[model samples]
Target chain A: MKITFPHLGNVYFAAKALFDELGIEYVVPPLSNKEALEIGTLYSPEEICLPFKIMIGNYIKSIENGADTIIITGSCGPCRFGEYCELQMNILKKLNKNVDFIVMDVPSDIGIKEIFNRVGKISSNSSKSKKEKIKALVKALKIINMIDEIEADAHYIAGYEKNSGDSKRLLNKCKRDAINSKSADEMINILSEYKRKINFIEIDKERKPLKIAIIGEIYTIIEPFSNLYIEDKLMDYGVSSKRTLSPSWWVKNTALSPLKINSLDIKKASKRYLSLCIGGHARECVGEAVIAKNEGFDGAIQIFPMGCMPEIVSKAILPTVSKDLNIPIMSLIVDEMTGEAGYITRIEAFIDLLERRRKSVLFRS
Target chain B: MYYLGVDVGSVSTDIVLLDKSLNVVEELYLKTKGRPIQVIQESFKILKSKYDDKQITASGVTGSGRNIASFLIGADAVKNEITAHAVAALNIDKEVSTIIEIGGQDSKIIILRDGIVIDFAMNTVCAAGTGSFLDRQAERLEIPIEEFGDYALRAKSTVRIAGRCAVFAESDMIHKQQLGYKQEDIIKGLCEALVRNYLNNVAKGKEIIQKVFFQGGVAANKGMKAAFENALGFEVCVPAHYNMMGAIGAAILASEAVKKDEGTKFRGFNIAQSNIIASSFECDGCPNRCEVIKLEENGIIIGCFGDRCGKHSGKIAV
Candidate 1:
């Protein structure tokens, strides 16, 4: 069976490594673009969120490229995202596109046996032995962790690099080279090599660059295309940025969440503001802003799609957070019509304000 | 020694010259009419007749067309309209607690306390309460845009017009006219509807404290200002330079930037005579197909942007 999945930032790299090692045929749909969004919008319900439309577009593109089976994770939720799989399947069926779906829902909801059965469908396609399959899974996890580490390091070091653009160049080159690697092992090796190079890249110890934290809805924050590559822009401006969410982080959080042991610090930090999960990542967004302020970030930027219900709550609460903490926070709600010039101007102005606040002692203690 | 600020928006291009002491030396407001470059050049020509280019220490650009403005004339500081509006309001009154700014294409609410912007929200993918909507209604009514506000203020009674969307509002206005409502009442109804739209959509949940300053091109409409005052049950003050606040704020930012950097990237006034061209093409490097834009001066590429991957932004020759 040929399998396909939607793009979510660096998760595609891990999927490539996993399928390749398992010796199963899979198709990685093209990275989301305007064409995909247009196609998705044409077929999707009018009120559906941006990520759903983008995912539907990815599925259609993958189906055209010979993918007959679609694998997606499932969420039972108070948010609209939980309803996407059913709606997407109906739309695709109505369009007469033949495809099978494998939804990996949580064991608590679908039961452990059902998960095993679903996962077994894919593993059964592989000719590898049980021990070998486990090894492949471990290797895939290692690859994702390594890549996330390399990316985090590169982003933080971009601000202090002795040679301007050194970190950005290396980070971009690393992604390009990994995508071009002929084998899963080669991709892991390339990522590790880049990780080593980034760690050793020359950085100025005396330079103090403005640092910011990116916090928001998971899909918009992690996906570069969705938020207009904000982290990349921050890197270009020689500003250090930090984000706690990544593919690897999501995996760990999801796995340990049922045990009530996941992201304990985030839960503790968010207690005063939002003690209960109100659906989606609203709590995480608020917690991250508070954490960022404590960590001495000059400011935080909260980005989410337009009309996102959960994020709208966070957006309202963030002003109180900003006022109480005495930190500046900017909320950018983006849609297809978001003008690039206005978005960039806001970011530049925020950076300028941060710089001025640091230099002008009157504004600070 | 003066700092120049230019706000190139969809409907209007505003320019402000500020002396070293932050006093407005000159202000020019011109219709953009879909030709930002020409309007900006026209304003510069008028300014050139009064002051020398060498006397301008630094310049900044703001508003929707800021990127194009920065490319055409080297800007030392470029900011967003929200920040610019807040700065200008604070400069005018340090006690100002809230700023309601509605421009040509967008409207925003800036919440400030102790002269710092704490929270803000701009209309999302909607332009129901902006100047463009008012301009369109004015055109349909066969009334001059400047006199539209006067007609609203002269109304004896009000009519309700749906203001959720521009199309709905227009059809509702036509329905009111069909019902034989007076022109003055309908205009006043539009103003009230627009204000209600702004309060519900843009300033939905914020606590709009006292000392609110209304600034933007739309602030010229005394009717809208009065509608805001009526809805909020508090006095609303419009700045003297209401339409030019963005430019004034940009000039203030430019002054501060020049002091900090001790340099200006201002291209001489001769830039109006230079042959500069801008164009865009989709890059096929990846699936994103980012539409990369290039600015050419004398047939040589000076700036390339809009690529999310920076594949083209990095390739530009400095």
Candidate 2:
């Protein structure tokens, strides 16, 4: 039996660990790529949204690589994520790919005992008694948490610092090694020591310097091509970026996301703006930018899916924010036609202009 | 140091010429109605009267209809509306945290953090809160589009009307009108209901914070603005070029792209006003029913793209 989770900035490490710990045979697809987008784009239907395309890409890549089964967290929600597993799995089958997907739709109203039950359904390990299964699940959960924390930090640090840092590098290596660890203590130890180093570091400026902040719809931000492997390309140009949203945020916000209710403030905001009846992320983006600038970051690169209304609002509001804060801003909208070259060139210039501005600020100060 | 940006969308084509620094030097708002090519030519003709094409250093294009605009005018940069809108927002106020934009066919929310887009959402299926919807309702009532907001503001009482979708919104507005509710009151109610439907459906699960600015053609409506303010419990700002923000954003992106590319793609002002041929064909590629649009200038295949798949994705020289 094998198991896998979707790749965020880093969940591959845990997949390796769970398979090894259970003594279960498994395989993970290579990191996502341009071809992944091409394949996914060809397969996915329009109107489903962007993240769906990328996730479909990841699954297609994995199943095509001979994986027998896939595991995805299940949810029921207002965010439309609850339906992803069923829809993506069906799409894969429609594409005539054969693979078993163990979709564990975690009941929002339930607890982690369900996790053990879901685990038990697959493993003969159920013979080991309930306590044993609980212990294993708990341990697995801890490792998952550690991997998530590391990934979250890596993304955040990458946001302020530059491309692949000591933290991100060490986290990747440590995550791999920890995944291969023989015991929970081993994974914990590696995770612990790694956390010890994530905080004490800074980017090597003389090495190279292009920095950007990636903030937008969760669909485009994490996916490689939905927005193009923008982070990778930026790194190719020696640019480091801070991407604020991640699947980790999805996991983190899982509990709080639904409870975020419509309030008087939303109504008031609607009146204040376009009396725009719906689509709300524009304001959150503004708050996020102020927060980034306060953190002493250089500039920001914004990305969003085409025809995404909430994001359009953010795009409209950001220019003023850039001016008042003295930060350079680049907003990229991704539809099918957003050629990578055109997007990347914009990034290079934005970075160039920002660097010049930073240098001048330094000289003046 | 004048720079220009053009936003050619499904319903309208807007243009903005900015200084090198992206300040608006000239602006054009023309109804695409149905003829994008003709309107663009007319826009150029108008701009030519005021500012010589020589003074324009760069230009950019954005929106759903931008492909033809870019191909026709040799745009230095071609960007989606999201990027253009975000850039325009940042250029105006670096502290702006949110942007709310509603056009004829759609509405969007873009969230910015320190001039970066941190979050965004868009409403595509519904037209209840969009400009075209309002335009239809305005016409049905025999009220001028420009006076819709003022009429809405005069309402002392609002009769609740359904605005969940275009069909419902229209019928409900008419029903209320038939019931003899004051025109002003019905208009106010229509704006409020549309605002409510938008917040309930489009902004459903997102966190909408502060420092919001309203843009797009629909923003010209004062009653809608009031409704938005009432809904969010906050003041919403409308930029000077609210109607042309998308175009301005395109212009900003164009200027930045030109600086990066060392040249402009704009085919020069004279050619922007030339003849163009456009058509579409169905691709039997798979069962997705993708329709690929083909555009040509004279006889040259300028560009092609659409919703379906690779059927006509490969351009065949005819």
Candidate 3:
């Protein structure tokens, strides 16, 4: 049976997780590029959002190579993702390609458990009892979650200096090792050992001074699109940074939060065990900023979309907290118009602030 | 004397330290535990334990999170992963015509003109065919992620799986399994789906050139490698440090930045002592609800971020 992932970002994480559980093999779409865009734009109707084009393109890419079934998540939110299954299905049918589809909506539409039970229909009947199926799924979820966690750690590492390959080599090795891991316990061991092996060179204490924290919505935070690549912008200024949250962290934190809710955002940010704050991870994120300040970071950054509502609310509340906390904060509202050069100029000045502040503190101390 | 590069992506942060001669010195792969600060702090602690006395000359930061890192650590130079990755690839194998990258959150295809990124496209929206997707598949099968390729290799006939997206892929896998397809066949089909997704999404517009180099975490999958070869009708080369190329790229850029800059703002190898603060303010300055952030240390504003306008002004910490 073939397995696949749909959509972007955490979907990758989700796919990894699902596969690792079932002990199955799956393929990855080619790196999305101009060709995929062309195929998607050509095949998918223009009226659909850009994501659809990309999604349809993924299916054809997989189908051409001999995939007969596709798997997708189910959503119920107002966002277009909720209807993605229907849209994608119609688009595929338009192409007249006979393929089976499994849309597993995460948020739940009709019933969560019932939808999940559909798994019984796929594998051996008696061989797969409810307990066994759940066990497999749980295992898969764990692996996927672990991979996501690793990816997140790597993002922060990306902010550092070293040959690009150094971190990637280590990360890939870690991922390969984790994937081939003997068991969950073994995976944790592999990750811990891997982490122990990393090396982060510190600048001359006399010279090395400024530290910043970057927080924001997932898209702008990770994707180069909405934010116009804020990471490089700050790096140009010579400031080190701290970021909050990654898929890996998100998953692990959720799994572990029941025991320590007060420490993690899953508890600090909302009533739910998970981060249901929408974009408002900002509230807890700002709290993290306070924590960072207490830890001695120089400043903080909030990255998000121009019109993102959850983050906007966070923006509204962040300043008052900033004033009370006495921490400097920078908020970047990005869109297509936010160019590279503009971002660089602002970042330069921000670094200047950090440098000057560091000098003053040095003099005072 | 050496330079270092770190590509901090959403899924993971990669650290690659290279000598002035461009020899590999040290490498690290870390999971960002909701705290990039902790990741760096941990890295520094580990690094100090190993090579605190080494004469490190320069460093670079790249990837989506580069700006945050550059400021936090005083990165010498900041470069884009595409440029850094392409540059490093060319340095390793100049003849490479195409570069494929599949990280945790996104996928990219870079076409080169004499080693420069003349054309590129990325799939930031879909997760159908990324390393993470494969990991999920591996999880479902209860197989080690590394052995996904082995499973694919054993498949006599692959039951096609649609990897259009994660949601579809998962459900489809379940369906195929219900159809009573062998696990190996399902896996092989899944491998083909990844190849299909990659080609259709990111590689569609561009010509499949020879001398293609596949990097990023996904390159670890042998099934994917074979699928790529089968689909493209050519061999795809996986870089030795395929996953860390972005970090290496940033390091290359950092090496240049250190040479170009005079002073360093590194917070020392013991950045553990440095304080970091993040806050937000919605800019009533306009209808745009811009939340500007200010960074400071010892009661002094050090840097600013999260503003769309230049309204929030200060010396940037990096």
Q: Pick the candidate with the highest TM-score.
A: 1
- lDDT for each residue of candidate 3 in A1-365, tens digit (9 for 90 to 100): 66555434444544554555455555555433334546777887565544456567677877776767777655565445567688778878888988777776432354657565755444433354567657766755665555555554554454463443344456556756765565445665776677666544322344453677777665456543335545544443344555665555555554464465534532353332224544335555556656667777777777765455556666666655565665666666654343243354344434544544444411110
User: Candidate 2 docking: what grade?
Assistant: incorrect
Order the numbered candidates by TM-score, best leading: 1, 2, 3
lDDT of 3 at A339: 26
Best by lDDT: 1
lDDT of each: 0.86, 0.68, 0.63
Enumerate the candidates' DockQ scores in order.
0.39, 0.02, 0.01
> Which candidate has the highest DockQ of all?
1
Angstrom error of the Cα, residue A171, model 2: value is 30
lDDT of 2: 0.68
After TM-score superposition, the amount by which residue B10's alpha carbon in candidate 3 deviates from its true location, in angstroms, is 0.9
User: Per-residue lDDT tens digits of candidate 1, residues B1-318?
Assistant: 999999998789999998888788899999999878778777877777788889989898888888778878788877888778888899889999999999998888888878777667777677898999999999998999999999999999999989999999999999989989999999999999999999998897788998999999999998998899999999999989999999999888887777777688888787666677778999988787888888888898777777776677773111
User: Which DockQ value does candidate 2 get?
Assistant: 0.02
lDDT of 2 by residue, B1-318 (tens): 788889987668999888866788777788998788788888888877677767777888877767667777878877667667878988899988888888877687776777666555566334578889888888888999999999989999988988887898778878877888899998999999988987876565456778888998889999999999999999999999899988888887777666667766666677555567778775554322345678777688777765321235442111
For candidate 1, the per-residue lDDT at B104 reads 90
Q: What TM-score would every model get versus the actual structure?
A: 0.93, 0.51, 0.48
